[model samples]
Target: MSLPMTCRRSSPRLLSLCLAIAGALAAQSAIAADSSAATETSDDAAHPPASDTRHAEHAEKSKRAVDLDTVVVTASPLRTTAGDLGKPAAVLAGERLDEDRASSLGETVSSIPGVQSSNFGPGVGRPIIRGLDGPRVSVLSDGLSTEDVSTVSQDHSPAIEPFLADQIEVLKGPSTLLYGSGAIGGVVNVVDGRIPEEAIENGFGGRAEARFFGGDQDGTTDMARIDGGTDRFALHADAVYRNAKDYDTPDGVQANSFIDTKSGAVGGSLLGDWGFVGLSASRFEDGYGNPGEPGDLSAGERGVHLQLRQNRYDLKGGLKDLWGEGNGLRFSFGHTDYDHIEFEGDEPGTTFTKNANEGRVEATFGNRDAWQGAVGVQGTDSTFAAVGEESFVPQTTTRGYGAFGIARRSWGDFQLDFGARVDKVKSEPDAMASRDFTPLSLSLSGGWKLGENWRLTANLDHAERAPVEEELFANGPHIATLAYEVGDPNLDKEAANQLELGLQYKSSLVDAKVSAYYNRFKDFIYLVDTGDQWYWDEENDYLPIRQWSQSNAIFRGFEGEATFHLADNDSGRWDLRAFGDTVRATLADGGGNVPRIPPSRLGAQLRWENGDWRASLGATRVNRQDKVATNETPTAGYTMIDAHAARHFDTGNVGWELFVDGTNLTNQVGRVHTSFLKDDVELPGRSFDVGVRVFF
Candidate 1:
């Protein structure tokens, strides 16, 4: 029998490796900006564009200087704010993303306060917010959920295309009321307008972008996209190819990032003054799998190859301004084709297929109001199958439907919200007992303003989750996690309720936010090891030779974030800033700590910028933790530090930026307290990635 081992994932090897490459890449892309009035100055050279003299003579006589203001509007709030939503949120420009050379969405966002990541391999990782993941957090695009298995399992990858999005939104609260139920943790929304500006006038506009990751995987992302619109109709399309080699760990630990992913998407819309009609189709295909770390082989030495192809189409429309004005309406129907199969050899041979379709309709009563409300309904149908000469599980089908409502109000100095939902899920498979689940969820919140810069916010949330068919009925080796997971068809739904309180403070130069929460669970759904590995067969396949049940659990935590504007010069030349976060969570009973929960951590940065030139230095400390859950791995404490610089250039109306990012500067090798297998599977040490961005 092959024994399982945990691979410590917090090592700073790959993190520091990237730092060594930054200087070389920076020198390779050295290009300076001009300072001729309209010209932008680079860090290497500075002379303030000569004050745009075109208006200088008259402007100087009047002694009037140019001033700029920023407005930030997000789905989380009822209205737009002055870059401060009063809740804990972070806004990162796509340009700043370039300077980081981040390969995965989690890696990019991990730089933010109170965020971490779950790494399956070099090619795949998911964001961990406040020590919570999976269905606890919802990831969406254009207000619609991405129908991928990432929400179901850690090994599965998300299907949405990140490179195509215009901006990313991170909502760290139960504000997911509108998106769906079971979002008691938080929400992540990736925004892609999918509209063409030129199409409105000339009927067309297109963009192309490419970035390369030259670390251990030697990976590359090449993409091209185009969109156009007419008086009443418009179209948008995108195509991308991503490929990478096996990655190398710190101390040259051998690993694999060898994966190939190809995806394409097309969408269209009909426009009008009151509302717009839209449609879109997308497909994602990839061949990838996770490998064992050294002796870690619960699933075995050779992992299953992946042949996954997912396709989806959506028909949607929203009233830009309707319901007599100041109101909006959204109607949508969506269909999906999901297929995933595990291969026989070094490459995929056999497979499994799942097909699904969903539809939803919702309406918003007001965009900005002291009182606002909305209601929506959604439904889904999904079927599953297995492939090859040796068939395993029989055909299975699952269906679900739900109705949801949300309302908000602000009176005096208090802002309050209430939301509720009811859902039903049913599933059937060959030779297995049928099952049905009815889940109810609700959330309520209230906030008070202590003063112009101080606020107190509180919320209570109740949610439930039904176990998936596979988790409830599986009888053989799934190969994803290398475990022969057995399912209990008689399992019960997991129900939870949580109470939270928060404090926020905003000032011209200082910002601070803190939150405390306590969550209780009834029949909480969790995975347990049978301690026996078996190769289950048909006649003996009621389960993977193991049994499962439910348990009661509780989770509580506190998180804090702070941001300081160290300095900002009136010359529009220089601005400096620093920020960081800390978090801690306590679990219930002898069930031990929650699995894959992030530990207490802190990060700080020093950034300076004047005009087109920018520079930064940062440090992060993740405390060492030995307190772990059953089957969970332990990681040592570690600290990391780094620095970088970049410059922007402009010619005519087009502009470009070249930058190099350094990571894991201090070369710390620390492990995480949140991983199930953190001991054997380690995080990549120091590494480097270089890239460029252009605006037209």
Candidate 2:
């Protein structure tokens, strides 16, 4: 099973995540917590009960994860549990979702150290983690690859339905070494408990939530979601529709980032103690645009206009003691169909279809205090189709197969994690030549425990990727901004060899972590303009005329984070925590800075809770990055501030609660500094929402 984190735009200003999980785009904004917890599992045994689903929604009210503290198990094929993660991570839950209604999942996620957002518009956004985006990141549904358009390019959207996940997981740094080589940056997993584990006895549980917002702009959401269980069966289903008018800039300029978004979803499943099974499907449609671009005011090509649709089904089974005790295996297979079209200027509309099917399986060896390791296989079969476009792969087929291994062991006073992965990628374009390549990667980590309150961890990773449809066959006008980009048929996959060193401290009141890294790239595939008719051709493809080649480059960075928990064990006051995370990046002396890479980033937050009420204040700083590389572009810096509070009403159910939310108390101006188009493209102005949640 491969659990993926899908990011989407929230509020009128929801998140724009780079990767579908978080759909990691740029537009995503902050959303309060609506997360759940998990339990550990033995090597060969199935888990007793899984955590609740973490839905992606924005409510006016807010709360902290501690209030609903829970671990997320079965994130991947490996039998790794929350406790095994050891590294720093955060989980969001219900009330927290209510409080941060102004933005989307990507925005809320950016609050984490080393995480950033890539916005497309209010309806589309995805998260970019630790400088990783595109094919390097994986977005899965319940541990199965989403295989949707979201991973194809920045202009595309993911197929995940955020308003329904049971919980969200953010894993930063080398800790994700076990996931995949591309995860050298990090991992964000969205957990949906739609599949039941324990048989229902008789009763069923469900919740309904609806939200609306009107301000400097207009916003409305019609969402109805519910999850309940019977004596031996549990099920879940929900639907949501959203839309927003153009928002005004601080200068009162009508930023064309207006949004016309709509969505509908339906899903259900059967539960069991040994494991559960289920199916889900959704549809998303929208028209959106960007403002503040240079050049002449183009024609009808304003923003992204699409009639996007998708469908998916997953059958997963959990088994223990395949042959004996303390031994188990998890298997899942999924298929998805996604289609969308983009309209740019006089350029004809460019449409594409992404049909993908994937399978994954993992086996783990179990024994307490004994050495442990897991081996798994992942395969993806996909087709990329384009309408009226001709190039490297206007219509092509690609496949990927990978095998990975991770091991853990204890040595007297220290622990070590050593792992490696090998991916074999093969592609065949219609009427074109066939291609094949295999990438090799590895990860190594060491931990030394000094009296339990202090520790040290160091990691190293070497990962690579093959070119995607856009990098090899992208040729068309950007419907949103009216710019054309022709693809370079002979581009090669980019590779990164990186290193990281860090220190960590955790006492009765505070936790802190700091790390520094360096990465070298070879045959890097980045988009460049051909500079004619404002009509663009991928520059690096062939220098002056007919040919085939690519550009090479390097990038490096440093990141750190810390937190202080003010509430003590003796205090029934609950949570009183202060935290912050930061990242800074630079290009090699001769290399141009990567386009749209944000400069130094800083964030701070304060949270308090007493019984049923909780409040929080957050502030973020993104420095301007005018340091342009020989061929890379530069972006400006900006600051964002937000605050929220919420009160919970327990329903007496084992895991059931309700709350109201308020957001953007100041309705601060929004900007995505790292965006390629950030001039007049400000984030949503401000917003608010109310919601309810239940779990049994």
Candidate 3:
């Protein structure tokens, strides 16, 4: 494959480092194999059997006052634990996930450090990692891309449902090596377990939940999931429905802020001692109003809304002991058909559609005592089209092919990880010259144990990304942003070099982690105001002109979180947690601050758990953002308070949980700096959600 122009012309050191790491890993693999075979007996006595080691680890974990860091991160190819990863990672599951679930994926995971949400309204929110959003972030479901048009517009919402997820994994910083070149900023993977990889433990199991929201946002949601299997086969099914009315704000009700959505899926798998194969079919439908452009009711004007639908199919298979006892091979494929319609009241305006397919195959091998690694190849093909008066981007077809390798090794108290990926992307716009780009990514991470309870970690990454179709071909009006948009067909690939340092501490009474990162970018792509306007006779007005532009930039940030186990006695167990994050992005060459960057935030939470009862109270303070880019306005910050409580009970053969969650308890008027509608709309205020869950 050809290398990226930037890499070929200016970044020889990055390419050399990647090659050197690959060569060293290849040699280490050979040495590891020989060493493993020669020292099998001696290593057994030193490390104990696998089962024994697991039991001991489990016993040690049980003694910990807090188990938040013990969860395994399924997003990793090697299935590394969150606490053991050399890079920054977070996982939300079990009761914590249940309490944090929201109408949108971004809202669900916004509480994590270094992560925030970009909001158009209550019905639309997408995850923004550090100071980056849009195409820079990749949203996945069960390791496969969601294949949604959310990246095309700031107002669109992700197609995936957060409530259905079994676990949510967030990887911060450059994760292009494991995902794709598009994920130069970060990755968020939602694990729903829609396709069972193993048989149900008791042959049959399921869960059902119903929830209601009161106060500002009046909504109702219901969902159900079932899993069943025989000794050789497994089956799974799930469905969800949600509806909400206009949400209230501190001043008044936010007009046209309503949502309606429904989704369902069915899957089945065949299991055997040698391997397992699974297939799944799913469908999603959503309809939500756009609060930013809520037309004037007194003038008899209708509001704008969006209706979206998608049908998807997935196939996955795995084989054990492919080449040796600890080796395995796995493959996954997904096909998606998506349709979205923008409506002016009851009349359809812009229609968007996409047909996409993606697939990947991976092989994993190595002994735990010496080294472990995975090698994989991935490919994707998609066609996107926009038709209507409001359409801004032309029809286009995009294809990508990639290969990657990752490995990890440990010696005594130090662990090291290295990975490399190369991708070729081709974008073809109708009646336009096709553009091709070869993006390469590389990463190296290491962790050193400073003591029994302290660890230090560092990471270095070099990543490159090809511009998306909209960035290359868009040339019309965009109603969402109220601007006349333009794209450049000759833009070059975007590249970044980043470095991160982290410190972590873990003990029976306390757990803490802190990280600092800096990223330098070449030819960073962003939208710029050209001080021009396009007169529109249809609207009897003029719209600002915004064009896709490129420049050199830098991003720097720090994030930290700490948890303290206060007490554990017959009365109950109490814990307190604190977290804070800050990020700044600026254009190089004195181009000033980047627009729409999230501001600094500090928060704390206190929790109590006793037997079947649990509760928490938290508050967050967001600092005002005054470092605005050219012609950009500043944003005022606010403080938010939230509380959650849940109780578990058993009835016959079924288990039940009742939960109540309250957000924005102070009814504060808050605005998201990253939102395009921040000046026109405020966040929902003072809402309480009550729910019940049933498990059998």
Q: Each model's TM-score?
A: 0.80, 0.80, 0.91
lDDT of 3 by residue, 310-330 (tens): 999999887777777657888
For residue 43, give model 1's deviation from the true position in Å.
Answer: 39
Q: Choose the strongest candidate by lDDT.
A: 3
Better of 1 and 2 by lDDT: 1
Report, for every candidate in turn, its global Cα lDDT versus the true structure.
0.58, 0.55, 0.84
| Residue range 182-238, candidate 1, lDDT tens digits | 354566665555532112323433334444554533666655555444546667877
Highest TM-score: give the candidate number. Answer: 3
Q: After superposition, how far is residue 69 of candidate 3 from its true place, in Å?
A: 2.2
The C-alpha stretches of model 3 lying farther than 4 A from their native spots are 1-66, 298-300
563-620 per-residue lDDT for model 2 (tens digits): 6776644343333333434344444444445556656777677766655566677666
- Candidate order by TM-score, decreasing, is 3, 2, 1
- Kindly indicate the candidate among 2 and 3 with the higher lDDT: 3
